[model samples]
Target: MSGLFSSKRLRWFAAAIVILNGVFPALWILFTSLKTENELTQKPITYWPHEPTIGNFISAFQDQPLLTFLTNSLIVAGLSTLLSLFISALAAYAIARLRLRFRGLILTAIIGVSMFPLVTLMVPLFEIMRSLGLLNSYWALVLPYTVLNLPICTLMMVSFFQDIPRDIENAAMLDGCTRISALWRIVLPLAAPGVATAAILAFVNSWDEFLLALSMNSAVAYRTLPVGIQLYQGEFAFPWPIISAALVVAIVPIVVLIVIFQEKVVSGLTSGGLKG
Candidate 1:
């Protein structure tokens, strides 16, 4: 092991292997998306397309209302994350700072609830949404997404809020700031790392949720990206190129977000790793 690490050439070779393992699937998808259907199913597969084209990308947008799907996904995910963060912030503050009775039990219950199998909750959730007349609206998705993610988000926020020095909030109170104002001005700013972590988790979970999205909104006009992309199938055949292109398009927002907030995300996760 020591000799392997000491050799620069061997280390570089190992790094290249790991990188290829991670990147090759994406490269394959991109290559397949550019291929004509004939090339996709050719007897002897070609590594590169004999004829490369952007027609699949164009058709992905034209054949489906990809833009509408994107909009629905953004609205549901963004709203769910924001509301989850707001609610979790207050909940975390109460449990962490106010030192509520049975705080540990409350947090444990929250974690247990979040661990419930999504499949088990589907039937009842569908019936309730139907009864409430929310079946075909954004509320059907947002409400569940926010609820499903709340416990975990609250847990992470608790961990983060506990990490803050109580003296800081105490000092703010001494300076004539009320508890609400101090939370708004002092502790929340310090807990930005945790908030970012919770926001990312909630947003991504909501964005990628498929089963609930599929069951809640059967209307094509109300579909989110994950379920909408699956619509590339037909009665007689499936179109792989257009499907792949749609998937690539679907993931663009998440990839861009992760890239932009990489630092905040890292800091948030690490800061929320400790307990009080």
Candidate 2:
């Protein structure tokens, strides 16, 4: 009885600590976002704003083409996620089910590509984008983001597919289903969780991608949210409140996505980690 009580107490304490850790940073950002520039810069730093206002958010958007930046970000991230998921799902199905020559070798190579530092490819990628007339266009960001995310997404889906029984595929085949039909009808439904996980990851990566977006997009209209937010800072100084507000705005969609699809995300991650 005592041991059980102690364990419960420890669990409660751990939960409280985890909640605190997660909530504090968001609270800090929120608190800072509400502060005026004067309050933010005041000596000895105010923990809470004396008079909270949405002026920072207004100013942040007013100072730049934030709506256009957000629209571009949404298009790039959304398209990148969809493309990555589509390509990776098909490739993962092939690698997981088919017995091609050097299948293992190919899978290893795909995984190995993900391990290479992205920075190493930046210059080459930039040159390629430039030569192809893709620079400053949506393709410049979307294509590279999709390709960069594909390896890991495919690997993740492959592992998830492997967890499913081969008998299921065989059954579908016996029912006169083609390989593609079986994949679309049978494997995809079972692998929905994994696909959702891959989509979330791809979306987040494409949305947050800074280096490539920065290098490839020069037009203010084409810039994504991250790059747009950089404009909040003048050459001489930064706008803390406006920057904080912009950051808060940027995080909202990601938070909503995670909240809405959190169950699938958790299930996919956990199931992918376990071998059947």
Candidate 3:
């Protein structure tokens, strides 16, 4: 009875801690975002805004093309996610299912490529994009983003596919289903969780990516939200309230995405890492 009571108390404590850690930072951001420029700069720091106003957000939007930045970010991130998932799924299925002599070699190469730091490819990638006249276009960011994410995404899909039984594929084959049909109809449906996981990860990476976006997009009209936000700060001065508001805006989409796909993300991660 004592042990059972102790376990219950421990579980409750853990739950409380998790909730507190998650809620506190978000609440703090929300609070800070509501403060005015003066209140934000005052000595002794105000915990709550005295006169909470939407002016900071208004200024942030007005000062820069926030909507344009957001639209560019969405387009780049969305397209990267879709393209990465499509290619990774096909490559992963091939690696996982095909009884080829070089299957192990191919998988090893794919995993090995992921271990290399992305910075190492910057020079070569830039030259290629320059030669192709894609340096200032969306394709410059989209193509690199897709390639950068492919290895990990493929590995994830491979693990998920491995968890599926081979008998299912064989059954489909006996029913006159081709390899492509079996992949699309049988494997894809069962691996929905893994695909969603890959898409979310690719989306987040592309959305938050700064180095490539900053280097490649030279025009103000092509700048992404991350790059545009940096322009708000100068060497000697910065607007804390407006910057905070921009940060809030940048995080909103990511928060909404996680909330909506919480279940699938958790399940995909656990199954991919542990089960397979």
lDDT of 1: 0.89
Clashing pairs in 2: none
Deviation from native of the Cα of residue 221 in model 3, angstroms:
1.6
lDDT of every predicted structure (CA atoms): 0.89, 0.92, 0.90
Model 3 ranges off by over 4 Å: 1-25
What RMSD, rounded to one decimal, does every model reach?
Answer: 2.9, 2.3, 2.5
Compute each candidate's TM-score over C-alphas.
Answer: 0.90, 0.91, 0.90
Clashing residue pairs found in predicted model 1: none
Q: lDDT by residue for model 1 over 18-129, one digit each (tens)? A: 9999789778888889999999998888988889999999999999999999999999999999889888888988998885789788988997898899999999999989
Shift in Å, residue 179, candidate 1: 1.4
Task: Identify the runs in model 2 with alpha carbons over 4 angstroms from their true place.
Answer: 1-22
Instruction: Compose the digit string of candidate 3's lDDT tens values, residues 1-276.
Output: 999999999999999999999988777777788898778888998888889998889988998888889889999999999999989999999889888799888989988988878789888889989999998889989999999999989999998998899899899989999988999999988998898899899999999999899988989888888998988888998887888888889889988898999999988988876865
Query: What would the per-residue lDDT of candidate 2 be over residues 86-109, giving only the tens digit for each residue?
Result: 899899998888888999899889
Q: Which is superior by lDDT, 1 or 2?
A: 2
True-structure lDDT of candidate 2: 0.92
